[model samples]
Target: MNDQKFVDAVFFELFDENFCRYQDSLTKPTTGEQDSYGRARNALALLNSAQRLDVVEFLRVVIADTASVILGALDGVHFPDGLEGECVVSLDGVEIQGDLQDMFLSKAQNLGIYD
Candidate 1:
């Protein structure tokens, strides 16, 4: 909700897509997981100090969207009656942890956001 958070979010969004796009271009180690979100957040930690408002605006739009919902879902999910659970799903032959991705896709579908 804050400017830094907004910029961080945009950075994450872009980082995520770029990571996926160039995945095959990068070499992988057998021991570590990709810190994709961490990379983006680190890139914008001082966003409020920056002069540009574009990244902040982009983060606002993104977080106001299903992507944020997905992140929330990834972290945790609550039902209408207050039930909660972890969610995951298979999409395009890849297993997506539905906890966040599903929540994101569902909201995006409702909002008509898609690839």
Candidate 2:
């Protein structure tokens, strides 16, 4: 799928499956062991986990296809072992919400991933 379609896909996924039901006190968790608050937090976390630049090509940021958005929600992130939790699109000034301004550089240098 095209890039715009990809981003929009992710947004729709968050909106349809989880966001709409987030206010409920008994909604199921996105991940295991998540309570009501955790479930709600997962919904935001899933959307926030998406890299803004990945789907920000041309003047598009969201796709017109609903299925595309649904599929895009599965795109999780994985930063390098030594880096921080936020994944960087690029090493220099080319980052986006995934760290458009280096949110973890200071700690990234001193961090260690045991996994």
Candidate 3:
């Protein structure tokens, strides 16, 4: 798949998996907290709709912006040449090794989050 499609797939997979875990962790919110939990559930439901592309796009932007800041902080670290094995990100059981900032920025640009 192309970089943008690949990144989008990875993003959605991660979001779906993590969001389910998050919902599980709540394990039935109390009466006072039900509204908040219900809202979250409704949001997820909306994301499943074809009409909610705008919501999905907005979420992608938010995720990319947040990830950029986190990954940008690693820019100052100097790794030895032989230490490449230590840096890897597993997406769909495949280990990808590269400069994460560059990878993320490229994908973000593909998403039109940056000019």
Candidate 4:
């Protein structure tokens, strides 16, 4: 993937965690939603720039192979057969291991990233 798309995926990954973390408090007609939204926006803006490479380094150290798998999936790159189920996604300290496509889609749906 290109650097821009890589940055975007990293930003979205962080945004998804923040959304899930604050979803309950982010109700309508309340400041909580605004707070969370602002945080998410700030996070994306900050991470979308030069700081993205640092974030990538952090991911490489913390998540290792999982990071590459996620980015690959987001970029529509298919993995070898039978390897899909080896993928593991970690969100906010919770880890889910399953088929790469299935896990990615389900996580994105839960984060309201897809219709």
Candidate 5:
């Protein structure tokens, strides 16, 4: 996929899936969680208009930078010693395996976000 498409796919994977999960967890949400959920819903709504391009770009940068930090921290460590060979990470119960950005992209692709 092209760079823009890849970015959009990753963003959609991150945002939409988490949004759904958070919505599901609001059955007995605290006040803070309820407020946060409201803000998240509003953010999702903003994506429908032209004014959200900058917001989307900003979120992309934040996601990339956050991924870099997390992946960088995991670089070159012995799995058995540091990660205990149980380092499996999942999104929505789907296994995701990779070092950094690949992890997120792989999940995105697995979810057919690129399609």
Candidate 6:
């Protein structure tokens, strides 16, 4: 798939499946409520645990396609604990830098994944 198509697919999986539902679960009327950071973190965690090849591949593609916007969104965002160790994009068993995790979270937030 092309870059944009791959990015869209990954996002569709995020929003259409577990990510949106997970955000809903985290919401509490009494509390001030969480933001896209939690939603993105949990979603990435789930994707990482699944070890889906398509997701990893598309992530690489989208990194080139959308890095600037994602990077811009990264400012002041708090990464989830252990995020550096848990989620990743690897090619031939070689893990890319932890920046990919931040990229993923930023993309999700920019897309309004929690909404």
Q: How well does each candidate superpose onto the true structure, as a TM-score? A: 0.24, 0.26, 0.40, 0.22, 0.33, 0.27
TM-score of 3: 0.40
lDDT of 2 by residue, 26-101 (tens): 2333555466566555544455334322222211222222323222222223333454443323223532333211
Question: Which residue runs of candidate 5 sit more than 4 Å off their true CA positions?
Answer: 1-34, 40-48, 76-115
Model 6 lDDT tens row, 66-115: 54444223322334444342334444455443354355556666764333
Residue pairs in collision within model 2? 9-68, 9-69
Best by TM-score: 3
Off by over 4 Å in 1: 1-66, 75-83, 98-115
TM-score of 4: 0.22
Candidate 6 lDDT (Cα, 0 to 1):
0.45
- List runs of model 3 lying over 4 Å from the truth: 1-37, 41-52, 77-99, 111-115
- Record all residue pairs in model 4 with backbone atoms less than 3 Å apart, i.e. clashing: none
How well is each residue in 1-115 modelled by candidate 5, as lDDT tens digits?
A: 3333444555566567653454454323234433766665455554654544444444544555565455434443224335434345445565443444555555545654444
lDDT of 3 by residue, 7-109 (tens): 5555555455653455464343334434666665455554544534444445556766666554444432344444432444555665443445566767667
Best by lDDT: 3
For residues 1-115, what per-residue lDDT tens digits would candidate 4 score against the true structure? 2344434465466555643344433222233234655554445445544564444334323342455466565444656455553344455555433344444444545644432
lDDT of 5: 0.48
Off by over 4 Å in 2: 25-81, 84-115
The full ranking of all candidates by TM-score, starting with the best, is: 3, 5, 6, 2, 1, 4
CA lDDT, every prediction? Answer: 0.44, 0.34, 0.51, 0.45, 0.48, 0.45
Question: Cα lDDT for residue 49, model 5?
Answer: 43
